[model samples]
Target: MSGSHLHSHDHAHGHVPVHSHGPASPHPAQAAPWSILRMTVVSRLAAAVAVSAAMWAVVWLSMR
Candidate 1:
């Protein structure tokens, strides 16, 4: 076959195997107490709603 010569060593496809020693480290944002990454889903939704309300109020006041 045309591709019969491709079967050689294990890394013939140009990708080296990776090994993990232990658990992965947490993301930087998750490590901060005041970061949004630490916020729960409900809290994030509430924050979004509060911001939207504030924006609409500002626009309404400016248009009056």
Candidate 2:
């Protein structure tokens, strides 16, 4: 209780102790851009319904 009236609380104590906080980042990978534009509009609407069912199966096999 006396050594030149000691006082230095190790820099006033408690200054840095965070398992997660600002100033130590490097954890990114949470895809988020409207889920890649909704998977590119559902793969261009399934390639425009498979090119309109292959052009309606070549116009119904050229009307047989």
Candidate 3:
């Protein structure tokens, strides 16, 4: 077999090499009113705070 076998189908199909297909929409999050970005951030923050409180409770109980 030759090195040509290692080549991608993009060239064979006369298609340009695309490194990235960027966001579908310029303002992806804002494009959709029900976008999960805001909810995701809020959930993550709430989880962090809950985890920290749980850890502190554990430490307090251990020290008592």
Against the true structure, whose lDDT is highest? 1
Model 2 ranges off by over 4 Å: 1-37, 49-51
Residue 53 alpha-carbon offset, candidate 2, angstroms: 3.3
Which pairs clash in model 1? none
TM-score versus the correct structure, for each prediction: 0.49, 0.24, 0.39
Q: Which candidate number has the best TM-score?
A: 1
lDDT values, one for every candidate: 0.79, 0.75, 0.72
The list of candidate 3 runs beyond 4 A from truth reads: 1-39
Query: lDDT order of candidates, best first?
Result: 1, 2, 3
* Candidate 3: tens digits of C-alpha lDDT, residues 1-64: 7655666555476676554446564533336665445678778789789999999999999999
**Where does candidate 3 have its weakest 10-residue lDDT segment?**
21-30
In candidate 3, position 2 carries an lDDT of 62
Clashes of each: 0, 0, 0
Query: What tens digits encode model 2's per-residue C-alpha lDDT throughout 1-64?
Result: 5658666566756676654535667655676756535667778789789999999999999999
Q: Which ten residues in a row have the lowest lDDT in candidate 1?
A: 21-30
Displacement of residue 8 (Cα, Å) in model 2 is 98
